[model samples]
Target: MTDENQRVDASHTPLATPGPPGAAPAAPGRARRLAAPVLTLAVAASALGYVAAVDPYEPGHYPVCPLFRLTGILCPGCGGLRSAHAFAHGDLITALGANALAVIGYFVFAGFMIVWLIRAYRGGPTPRLALAPLYWWGIGAVALIFAVVRNLPFGSALAP
Candidate 1:
């Protein structure tokens, strides 16, 4: 190859070229394959277990929403734990009654996790859940609106 065409890739290290001294060997492929699903399941189970046991409805178990306590206004996450607790117990009506928005979010999250777990188990690429800045801003706006509306007399039904 001509000198100009004989390019060297600094990042490329031929096999048998050990990594920097003391660098740990990479994990086995089997370990990597199982990691994602195991971690996801563990996190989900722990969260559900806590919500199922402690009971958010009991006044002392969880802290009150500071914003709601101080300003007497509902916040987006005010009833979220209660909603999760109800959903965990399979009471759809009570879950929705506690916090409809949070209930919807729980289902959306469950759907995404299902996709993620399926992809992980099959060794397929995981789905990207990124949203654009515009979408994030829109979500924030909607939450703010929900909070405001829920505090109003007409939107009392939306309140926890």
Candidate 2:
């Protein structure tokens, strides 16, 4: 397209906004850009808030882990809710004790989200979140080791 047509079209486009004083302008649709990150943060906060308010340690408040109930074995997710509750309540030690794996996952998620939000706000493309197949296998191996060790008589400390 000719420069004149491009200029006219840009002005009429919904995404374009006025430039800052003597600075390069931001991308268009900045308002629309906020929804995804904002919704993600809100959802995360709401879930954490709910976990903070609810006592996961109290029996009957939350459902018992079906796997634990059925097999008497502690699953990887057995103490996840309790871990969330402890983290939300600012008891890092308790949270770690409840589920160290889940705590690690929480930190990983939080870091990913921080990057996601920053990129979103700056109008950059969202970062890829996929892990390589090898990484996934390594994670699975670690979890399997954790599970087997926890279930063994010697690794009761890993149990919730």
Candidate 3:
């Protein structure tokens, strides 16, 4: 066949493979779109419920922080469980006292989930943090400062 005939045949062919005969391409259902956000909220609620039920203040209820155990230093995550427990029980003051950073984290996560759920329900694209590298470094710096200050005598109020 001449190049012109071959070109004509190729041009006539569909670019994408067709679906089953007489079948229309299906769009994602509302349930499918909302699945991720709903599942995430459910898991978080379950976890907080467990924390609320259990007493983390009691010894043996939860494992000791390895960093605190070994180095006598409180890491950023120290007292997070206790904070979560307090937060779950509706004691904001106690939650902040347990771990202020964790309380802040809880608020941040709650905000993110709220936005995600709203967007998912509206059939919008999934939300992304999209923080720049500098912002990430700044966050790390804040955590490090929090860790250091909480361990200091002057920052006793900040300590767990």
Candidate 4:
């Protein structure tokens, strides 16, 4: 028979290859992945513990930002620590007061992390993000608005 047309006989069965003589048994689900969410929670808890022990609010602990100290301009990361501290303490209002934008960012990060963890543990296909041109432009616009609003006299409350 031609190689293309050849087929195995129905009575014949394929033989299994022998493993190395002294190899230890492999664990079941060895290929199964570990969940990322658990690791994230552990790391976050550790960070919170450190933050609590070394309170940044205490004077002379962390260095002051040159930009904010010199120019009085609030950078994107300003108030991030205070916001995180408030968040860790379970005071949402205080966190928002410290940095509204950071709080919004925190929520978005949390939501995405939760979704990513769920899909990973369920053996679902990894999530892929494809932002349309409009979406990207919208994000830029929002950031611009946040910058302007935070600096404005009326929106000073939003400032860090």
Candidate 5:
């Protein structure tokens, strides 16, 4: 055979040696697979820790919500920081009172993180939200409704 043919054959060879017959394919290293989830958890934990240490209840520590300041209307995210502070301090009732929607969001985020960590540990594909357009619109609608309700007199309990 010509050198060109030999080179072509060499190029077609597998990069790694084949494992024993019928053996399952090798997975990524545990550390490599867990890196993203662990890093994400660390970042989240750091942020929560900061919020827990700092007092959002105290003036001047955090910026006021722009929408609430300008319009005097309670936007959906208006009390989110306060909610986080309360949540991090183990005050579930206070957190919910500050912003029920934000409290619910925290739980949803926790659930997603748990699923992601589990899947990553097992070397499975990363978890995706993958919500359809309808679901996206539904989420938007819920936020809008929450904002409106929180601003109304009847929803004073929901206000921060």
Candidate 6:
């Protein structure tokens, strides 16, 4: 063919060429990102539904912590479910009685989740928390303190 005839016409806009036929589709990271928020909402809804339907503190519905039974030692996570159940039922005092630290954690998590959902829906940047090593150490120390104090007579109020 002559060069003149072979050349694409500048006046005519080139249409987008379709991708390769039968080629494995490219991985969809964006779809995965979008799915995350839906999954999170589903999980939160399920949790709320469960909390509404069942009482964690009720006898025969839940089991006691083996650690609390064996050594009479309260772990950092002990009574967390009871705390959540109480909080879900709007019994703040009982929630605090069940696990003060866990109640605080629940609030922090709720705040974080709300922010995450808002950002996700708005197509905003994900929030980042860059905690220093000292901050991490401080968290561990606080948990240790909670564990120790809740077991002692002086910190009896913290105990479940």
The worst-scoring run of ten residues by lDDT in candidate 5 lies at 1-10
Residue 125 Cα positional deviation in candidate 1, in Å, after optimal superposition: 1.5
Q: Point out where model 5 deviates above 4 Å.
A: 1-26
Candidate 3 structure quality by residue, lDDT tens digits, 1-160: 5676446565675556457745776657889989999999999999999989999988998899999999999998998999999999899999999899999999999999999988888888899999999999999999999999999999989888
Q: Write the per-residue lDDT of candidate 1 for residues 50-89, one digit (tens) a residue.
A: 9998899888999999998998878988888998999999
In angstroms, the error of model 2 at 159 is: 1.2
Write down the lDDT of every candidate, Cα atoms only.
0.84, 0.85, 0.91, 0.74, 0.90, 0.80
Per-residue C-alpha lDDT of model 2 across residues 1-160, encoded as one tens digit per residue: 5676446554555554467545677565755776787798899999999999998988888999898999998988878999999999899999988888999999988998898888888888877868899998999999988888888999888788
lDDT of 2 at 102: 94
lDDT of 6: 0.80
Which parts of model 3 are misplaced by more than 4 Å? 1-26
Give the lDDT of residue 98 in candidate 4.
76
Please state every model's RMSD to the true fold in angstroms: 5.6, 5.7, 4.0, 7.1, 3.2, 7.8
- How do the candidates rank by lDDT, highest first? 3, 5, 2, 1, 6, 4
On residues 52-137, what C-alpha lDDT tens digit does candidate 5 reach at each position?
Answer: 89989899999998888898999999888899999998999999999999999999999999999898888788999999999999
Per-residue lDDT value at 147 in model 2: 82
In model 6, state the lDDT of residue 17: 40
Segments of candidate 1 deviating more than 4 angstroms? 1-31
What ranges in model 2 sit over 4 Å off?
1-28
Clashing pairs in 3: none
Candidate 4 residues 107-138, lDDT tens each? 88778777776776766665666789999899
lDDT of 6 at 143: 99
